[model samples]
Target: MTDQTPLRSGGRAARRAARAKALPDHMRPIRPGMEGGTYKPLTEAGVEAIHRAALTALEEIGLADAPETGVAYLTEAGAVQGDDGRIRFPSALVEDALARANRAVTLFARDPAHDLELSGTRVHYGTAGAAVHLVDVEDNSYRECGVQDLHDAARITDTLDNIHFLQRPMVCRDIPDNREMDLNSIYACCAGTMKHVGVSFTDPDFVANGLELLHMIAGGEDKWRERPFVSNSNCFVVPPMKFATESCRVMEECIKGGMPVLLLSAGMAGATAPSTVAGAIVQAVAECLAGLVYVDAVKPGHPTIFGTWPFGLDLRSGAMTGGSGEQALLTAGCAQMHHFYGLPGGAAGGIADAKMPDMQAGWEQMCSNVMAGLAGLNMVYEAAGMHASLLGFCHESLILGDDLIGQALRCVRGIEVNDETLALDQMREVCLGGPGHYLGTEQTLSRMETDHVYPRLGNRSSPKEWDELGKPELVRNATAKKEEILAQRSRARFDAETDRAIRARFNIHLPA
Candidate 1:
């Protein structure tokens, strides 16, 4: 007598909506820190040979132009200094530093949700580089990059699901003062997104200014040190066995300030480094090992990434060919070396020689992105948005790259195998007792959203449906997505008081 009619609204549609809402975090098919290393480009013997060669270079050629501070640090770590002013690392010293280095590092984000655990062969892709120009896809032109552009890049990266982190993708050309540029770059990026950021300073003196801003954002110096969200991408070496004096000093400050360091050694093949790929790798490894000794000398057990980034050269023109097949092999081989030493490492990938996001750019971006993930690169830098060998950054292309990296990470996740996944029971039921085709079975309906990744902007409709939808191009859709994301104000920004204090203390250019 008390029973009433049950409320129902659009029965089938409501049921489908319920199924979509049931997919939770653990059910996601692809996620951060998926194990890789399935593609082994280097054999065991080859890795050993390369290691020995690197040690030989360090012990023989040595590194010249080591600053006084660096000299003291390295000398304390068992390195030798000759009367000729070259600091040479003995094989024992190099191995000792390697043994003491952090095998894994957690690159944290302001929001705990984005922390990346870089250990073993776990893979993560993100944005990186210091491109001088911004690509105007509408006009097919380029202009000098400014601080606002950098903030916008971070803002877009914050919203993208597959872009794991945000490094400084472009330079603040409008800010002429180096100190102001460094501090403002940190402010603008941190304000734009809470994802872990990677920043570089032109001078060691400027690093203090940048760190001051970071300290404010993290609430205090101790809090910043406890969970350092930013890493210094220090290019410590000038390639071919020489130290960049200023950058080395900067690296020292970064190590002591409790920030993680990417001991970057970028040797352009056929130009600064050897013409052969193996020869380039050997030089990069030796240089980074020297950096390793220096870091341990400053502070033992500091978090550092073994960054052996060797860019390929176009022999015909002697210009960089960062999108070449050879570049993929070089990065993959470097990952193998990092594995050999059991150290956390990073390498460059997903760069394009094409100036815009075209068909050529698509092929070039995917090749290295897939290989870097499969080769088990702990951190894949420059994995999106870079073009023209890193001379230009395209916002539209960065949006498109979100889809590419999602697919690449799925590849890294590989295929899961179990009784449930094999689905022998479901297969038999469909073939023997049920419908000839398995379109909407119970198992299929349950697993559709969890087992597969669908692109946000990539079109997969049939020809008729595509025409009906006006044949939207990928870049156009990417442009619309970029506009849509930028239109929304970011919730992950500093409070008004902090922003005002930063702007008042420093020459911050971002509008309040």
Candidate 2:
């Protein structure tokens, strides 16, 4: 055979031409709110065992340090307050709260098109953390994240298609005042993206201030109440069956203010919680169940997320190992429990124990992301941009993670088994009477975008092509994309009139 006997220029041209056409939104297969739950890491017996253990824990050991309001509400709703001040729940009360919990809740966005209907195992990925430092990929160092970094993170999140929501990912280290820090974080995230935003408050009273700011952004108190787009990611419990008094108070105010609440229970195994994975899940579930009862007692049907985040522990040194296989299984198991209770829920995943966005980070992020998505987590938090096991946040990694999540969502989407997909006719045509190859076929060209995912920074070039291009690095490409998105000069999301009013009232740190 000659060196170049065949000429497939026409086929190559046709493939390129087909890819150039934009696929419609409906046909785009990989998007937000895709159905998951195809993977079940926990067995039926195992789930039941964990559920029973959680109930027993609530009924027996109970949770200590309940705020007065929470104690009163929960006690009135059938919880027993012991002389030691530990509030214990009977299994009936837990079951009743689960019955009254909002199974299908809609997390709204300022732009209605981005609304998230969290029900069942419908999966969505987003950024979430309180990383104080920003991973300076260029300098190979870390620096304290300021208000502008938080805003820029949101803006980048707004532009990413795979990242469905913009959870407040970084703490505004520059804002010194606690109240101002809380308020400014909300303003920065809201001004950055129209996607549904999730934030936390150090003080309960700060929630009211944050609410006032949200009202101004929503045009009025009534409008903000009508469609509360923000959620309070409240860590209600301090692991091992103890309530965080201040955070519980904050959750109560958030619920009273007509805001969604995420009852986050983060337990680190082998330290604050039991070393066994199932035991860790039991503690998380019991704590969140107590939280659910607290919310239901305060206001029945209030939207709450069963945030059972159980982090893995490296027993060797007693540190969090968020990127380990155990972490993936822990998160997936938590998702199964959410499905077991039929409540809207979220779990932690897509985090990297690696300090940088290298090959290790990529594998670690994808392992948990794929597991979380496959297990049908409604909200996959910390799914992007987190590094050093949540100590650092990288803007470049965040941009690159968008591409990673797209592929994970594709796996959660699974496969279709229709007659057309069976492809008997195409097989016959190719083998019996047509060309030996299937490339450039009608089905191949049509399903290019729908059935396949294309990454923005992942290289698919041949070795020779890569050498010809001077070997572009993924981080460098991601940095360029981040710069390109931030360089855009449009801040119309926050109109000048409203922005001036906000700045005049509060110390809005984002510059014009």
For model 2, the superposed segments whose C-alpha errors exceed 4 Å read 1-18, 490-492
Estimate, for each residue in 291-355, the C-alpha lDDT of model 2 and write its tens digit: 99999999999888999999999999988999999999999999999999999999999999999
Residue 261 alpha-carbon offset, candidate 2, angstroms: 0.4
Q: Which pairs clash in model 1?
A: none
Model 1 regions more than 4 Å off: 1-15, 19-22
Per-residue lDDT of model 1, residues 452-508, tens digit only: 888888889999999999999998889899999999998668998888888888988
What lDDT score belongs to each candidate, Candidate 1 first? 0.90, 0.92
True-structure RMSD, every candidate: 3.1, 2.6
